[model samples]
Target: MDIIPQIRAAMHTLLSTTTEAIAAAQQYVKRPDRAKFTPSTLVQTLVYGWLAQPTATVEQLAQMACRIGVDVSPQAIDQRFTLATADLLRQLVLASIQPVIAANPVALPILQRFASVRVHDSTSIGLPDALTSTWRGCGNATTGGGSTLKCGVQLDVLTGTITALVPTITGWN
Candidate 1:
């Protein structure tokens, strides 16, 4: 089935609203010294690139931005992907979830038997020794002796949306 039209429609509906909410939140203050791209533009570009190609590289993202009339270097684009960027993207994802579910309801016959279906998974990433104090490691048992960051995500299978995402130090649990 053709999905491009649907994707475009969803983007049209959500992008501006999400961008406005993000701007109002003031999550990322624009620094006068380095204000090449607005949060909205960066968010839109990243979303588009991800949707178009999940494994797109920083260079590809930079090219995509250029195609859309924004001249930016791959390094600049990469630098923009900080913890703050992740938080902002997560917020945007959470915000668009309801609308996404509403637009694309689950129709699989096998899934109809359940009132709700959810899935959960976690991933751990090893961090540098410097981050040990900030994000405690899992000790000698897991990551040898370095800090580790673990993140868990709960997905609503029926709606094909993420219900929650929790990030914590590996030593927490």
Candidate 2:
């Protein structure tokens, strides 16, 4: 069928299943009375490489969702980013995908065989000034007032699917 329909169906299937990580992450989400991006849906977003994009903004993410027939606004998705609830979901998505990656199914590999999931890979997800102060002026050359921006990770340990994603961090000391 058309790409939108196909993507929509895939999104459905991705979020439809349940697992321990999903449950825990969901509880993590609701506990803070956060904005709406169910843990399952967040897991799907992270799993599908949506959040993995170095320069993917909420607007871009929402557009990606719309490509799959999801009509939510970028503003809404951007708001969800603050919850920090998605971090756990990111880990869960990585863990869940580890098996598919390891199998190297030659069909739909979630991660390439033996790829380095952790590295200095990121771009501007959104504009500099509009983001939170912490998100602005990154690395050692950053503006003094804000905290550093974060880059994300996706690792496949003896993989089938993604097994872990460390978080959008400022790298090591």
Candidate 3:
């Protein structure tokens, strides 16, 4: 199987979901009355936009929206950032994460010697004191309260595929 078609199929699977299903699942849009940007479009815009440029600005994302056949302003896109949007994006990311198994694996003698080569790593990120209630962290001397989150990923080097993603919130003692 060609990798291009496989990738296209994966993308289509991710973006082909109905807006009604996403709205009901994520509760993103309550009333779709005369709404120009649907939940699907929003997710599509962000997914493709960020995939094209991970550090894309709101204006660039708006351009991506235009490419996807929606005309939304940068400010309009910026205003859409809320708790609901955050939750929706988070859920979409978690749902879209699947192991990528290529038909042709990497051609490396050392890597091929093993049946499978897996790697794992994790990182902890500090959060603002205001979010301590939600994501408690080990106390800090400066603010006396802090929050942190640990994120980890497992990957198969030979297949160049991500196997798992884990996110854990730290709690204060």
Q: Which candidate leads in TM-score?
A: 3
C-alpha lDDT (0 to 100) for residue 20 of candidate 3: 38
Q: Sorted by TM-score, highest first, which candidate order results?
A: 3, 1, 2
Q: Write the per-residue lDDT of candidate 2 for residues 1-173, one digit (tens) a residue.
A: 34677556544654655433465645665543644555556555544535558577776677666655556787767666643544555555554443333333233355455454432244323334544444444345444433344545443333334444444533212
Off by over 4 Å in 1: 1-7, 32-34, 103-173
In terms of lDDT, which candidate is strongest?
3
* Candidate 3 segments whose C-alpha is farther than 4 A from its true place: 18-20, 99-121, 125-149, 154-164, 169-173
| Poorest stretch of ten by lDDT in candidate 3 | 96-105
- Model 1 C-alpha lDDT per residue in residues 57-142, reported as the tens digit of each score: 99989887887667899998999877678778767766766555433557889998997788789987887776776556667656
- Judged by lDDT relative to the true structure, which candidate is superior, 1 or 2? 1
The sequence of per-residue lDDT tens digits that candidate 3 reaches over residues 30-139 is 67796679888888898889999998999999999999999999998998887688667666555566623333457789788897888899987777766766656766
lDDT of 1: 0.74
Q: Cα deviation in Å at residue 152, candidate 1?
A: 7.6
Looking at candidate 2, the ten consecutive residues that score lowest on lDDT are 99-108
